[model samples]
Target chain A: MSDTMTNTQATGGDGAEAPRGVENLPMVKALNAGLRQAMLDDPRVLMMGEDIGRLGGVFRVTEGLQPEFGTDRVLDTPLAESGIIGTAIGLAMHGFRPVCEIQFDGFIYPGFDQITSQLAKLTNRHEGQLSMPLVIRVPYGGHIGAVEHHQESPEAYFAHTPGLRAVSPSTPNDAYWMIQEAIASNDPVMFFEPKSRYWPKGEVDFSSSAVPLHASRVVRTGTDVTLVGHGAMVTVLLQAAELAAAEGTSVEVVDLRSLSPVDYGPVVESVRKTGRAVVAQEASGFASIGSEIAATITERAFYSLEAPVLRVSGFDTPFPPAKLEGLFLPDADRILEAVDRSLAY
Target chain B: MQFLSTDGVFSVSEQSEQYAPYLERLTEADHRRFYRDMSVVRAFDVESANLQRQGQLALWVPSFGQEAAQVGSAHAARPQDHLFPSYREHAVGFVRGIDLLNVLRLLRGVTHGGWDPKDPTNGNFHLYTLVIGSQTLHATGYALGQKLDGRTNTGNHETDEATMVYFGDGATSQGDVSEALVFASSYQTPQVFFLQNNHWAISVPVTTQSRTPLHRRGDGFGVPNVQVDGNDVLASFAVTAKHLDDARSGQGPQLIEALTYRIGAHTTSDDPTKYRTQEELDSWVAKDPIARFEAYLRSQNAPQSFFDDVDAEAKDFASDIRCRTLALETPDMSLMFDHVYSEPHPLLEEQKAWLAQYENSMNGGESA
Candidate 1:
């Protein structure tokens, strides 16, 4: 229907034009493009997970990848998370870098044992003698009007492990670059892609000025207060900052690119400058990444605080209905309310 | 090396010649070392069980009577070969050069995994896998990697490599095991599927897990399979060596089922006395692998000091394990965000910040 061959560059200045290689495509299309590039770059690269082939993935994130790569490379596996990851580990050991999909955040539990116990420790147990060199792609977080087990933020579980690397991307540009970067790492990486942002289009640069997957990026700049978020929440944070700007409050937004081995330098520097910060995410407030960052700021930059660090997070309950998700998710109003509260303090 | 037959007389298989040449290589001194390693590993197993009983561990899977099966096969593997072990392979970990303390740390709930597997010097031993039959798939995959890397049957004894994966009768029932077998058979992956048919899976017995002999499951998957006396260290060693060598030579995947018994509770949380009788326990105890090996060693006129030295070594190793386990420090609570991904994530930053504030507020504005 569209000119698939025309890699038309998107308009310049705001960086909204189609990328040099992928012109005017949706997030899912860009993902498929990245997968194709990765497969061509490395022969060891293979894709396997549930409904990834033939069915084209639940979200069609892997649409057309199977036909191009063939069934041997892009495998549609049986309905077993443990089997998917367990086999991926075997494939990795045999010199194949498997990019496994866990289908959804809630469905990753069955394979949790394999990922945390076997895949995470295979390299460390051999005392650095072996490297898993595999990538696990999980579509996580809530915001889609979906039912139970479909929307969950379980990044904390994997982040707690010692040997695995965890990361998530919010934009099409970061998604394209990060997926390829994750596959090239010697360590095992758990790549969490926000399902809600899968269709959102953004400009991606394939010319490799793209930051490393583990580094943080400052998406929006401000001075009065810092708004920190990631994955789907990054987009929300940027929008919230824009809304705050109309009300004359400057907001600095930090898009933490990596979950584990976090680049706290950018976050701490921003907090030290702003003296006021509001952390927002869709995951529950109990024992979450928000808790870790809040504590680190207090410890590392206690004197810089003009007020206590404020957090606007989802309720400490199961992810609610799509109708309630708007209220449940931290929107511009909730973020601005926290910012106002922090300013008042 | 045979000390007993099915009829209870000293006998060796006609295939013994293949291993007999290596028997003389294991002099009295070497036998003493192997015995010492087994004794220490068994002591570690007992102490781990005690720790679990005392609530120092979340759970403990004892490898009491199955030590010979583990140690014999582990010792038979070359340094270059890799090992993938199920959770119960405590003795195999010891033989593969893992410190006894690391095993204790895992059972004590201090860490999910106790070691790194990538370091060739870690003796190519992987962390203990808790999922029943999953490691079989990993082993097969690793074996395939070895084949592709030109590491198998390189015609150089010092450089050629193979892989061994250990599981139990219960794991044989898992779909992953059968799938791994099929893949290994088709690819001719240089791997040995070492199944320790230890007679029980928690409360379920061997009969409940499989309709026929567990080894036969491999045959249906197209992997050549064999059965061995798991209680006989010499037999286990001979059989595993043959299979491993065959795999290394690119002859394809092989499955060896070691018929053994779980001489203790399935774990500290279990009480077998409810389902099995003391009579069954007594029967397996009489066929204790260590005792059988000891008898054969004595008949060979092995020195009395060898047994004395092994007992002393076991006590010392047990003391070290206890000391190290008791001294382990609780992990930093903030380490909760350390390994989720190799890259930075904005959401995690927000969550970490929120947690810090929550904890500090709960702690009366003091840093937590």
Candidate 2:
């Protein structure tokens, strides 16, 4: 094995007997580990963003990468979002796996034209002559009381584009595995990191692999109602499931890992078994990822569903200030309220 | 701006003198070949615009007055160097060994893009980026890749390769263009930014695009930049060749603002008369690059038979392109979903089947 692979394997902090035995790590550190492993496995892997090198990113997800791999691989780009993505597209065309960070969700719009017009369409436009093996990492969602643009959830816009794959990981373990999987895939992946969960610790096993990047997973199973969500909202759904269980009402929580080609198979199965569902997200309810989940569940599990598919999402208003964000975001209370309504029906 | 004078006089500035060796290295045969290339592509340009007017092509972006800027720089680039062009770089595409009809396939609305950029026979020329100023960043990124692979800065002129991207004056105003300049400067990527200041950007004049010279904008981004008489093919060739050499030898990025004029409308859809005046247009017409070069070749005792042979070849080439464009066939409808992902996408497969079924329904039956 190469030195980087050995380094990651040794650094995971778990003894060899438990192949899946993991180390307790935050989402950011897990992402860092994933990026480190990916770079070690493939010399072609590159990380580019503002403040990614010395600053290790605003979130520090790419921390220590420059020192470990050298600045050539972990590039510190100028403050230009369009340039970052456009150049990354070029690098991808020239056979480099570029993982670009938009830093925050709100700042991604400037580079949106490049991502949608060039990165997304390059492969299809070139008639398969080119493959864009690129990953655009954006820290999205709200909970830590950040201001506007910083807390926006723009996955719906990217998921709507046919040529892009949008995926989000709610836990550190998934973050570790999915980031590596995204780098390995030939398609361009829009990786949404749940910033609220960046500091949350979880057992991240580097020794073994996780599920495929695009597949949805039922994190916690119940029979009364299916609470479907992804990214940060998955935590809220899990908490709501717990709260509902105490009330003698069972709730199944499904983390929709990949938003674009949402693994509707598991979603449909969960909804059919539970006979009720509620999709939760921090983004506004109008034409959101939650809407797609609700629509898909209704179509695939129409006869099996006892109540209409409901959604517990943020109000259809602009992302408010830090003080009002808590009121705007979907939490366990709102999720429980939606579950109660679904159960009452 | 007039190095090779409009009156067939060849004068060299100190800057042009640095590149004079490149010009001296060229033989009578090379000059004739350059003249032939310019003449042939111009004929092809005129024929393309005519086809658009005659309702053959959906739209045509004419390179009427900007042939010299493209042909000269394209000739200067090494075979291993990657080239990125905006839509109107017809001459560059031709020099890159692309079957020019492939470009027509795109303009004719029969294909998404014409040729595979990675195809070696296509001269390492990338597919044309229709979006203004975007290709500059891609070129810079490709140059960065070259640097990472140790493909450049080897101190060996022949083995060291660089990248070149072409854009118009108006594209310089774009955020992506400025960003590309910033990244190229920061990374010291081996690349050249070839901006053709073709006096008019559709209806907008170059004056409105930048207050200072476009090359000066590169100075603020830390890239060494120069302005050339874009109409003088020799200046374009010499300057581009030198700067490309500098970039290949680890001199970082260089910018060349080629001062030229667009003799035709931006596209067949444009009305240039509304924005530009007849006096300005007539003045630029006198400094036509191909005409001036033809005059210089004649002054150098070029034979009449050579010019006659080039003219004949240009006519035949134009006719050949017209025939190929007319004979172009639409690809299978299934091709739409073919390259959406390298791996099969279930949703795309379902949509492809739906479209096929929808088309079959129009034919009064569904396939088994």
lDDT per residue as tens, model 1, A181-220: 7888878889999988998778775654447778887888
What's the CA error at residue B74 for candidate 1, in Å? 5.1
List lDDT for all candidates, in order.
Answer: 0.80, 0.89
* Tens-digit per-residue lDDT, A1-345, candidate 2: 011222234332244332335799999999998898788778899999999999999999999999888988999988889999999988887799999999899999999899999999999889998999999999998987876789999999999998899999999988988888888889999999999999989998776656877789899989999989999999888888888889899888899999977888888999989999999999999998989889988988999999999998899999999999989998899998888888888
The best candidate by TM-score is 2
Q: lDDT score, residue B227, model 2? A: 92
Candidate DockQ values, in order, are: 0.21, 0.62
Give residue B71's error in model 2 in angstroms.
0.9
Q: Is the docking of candidate 1 incorrect, acceptable, medium or high quality?
A: incorrect
Please state every model's RMSD to the true fold in angstroms: 8.0, 2.8
Position A9, candidate 1: lDDT: 33
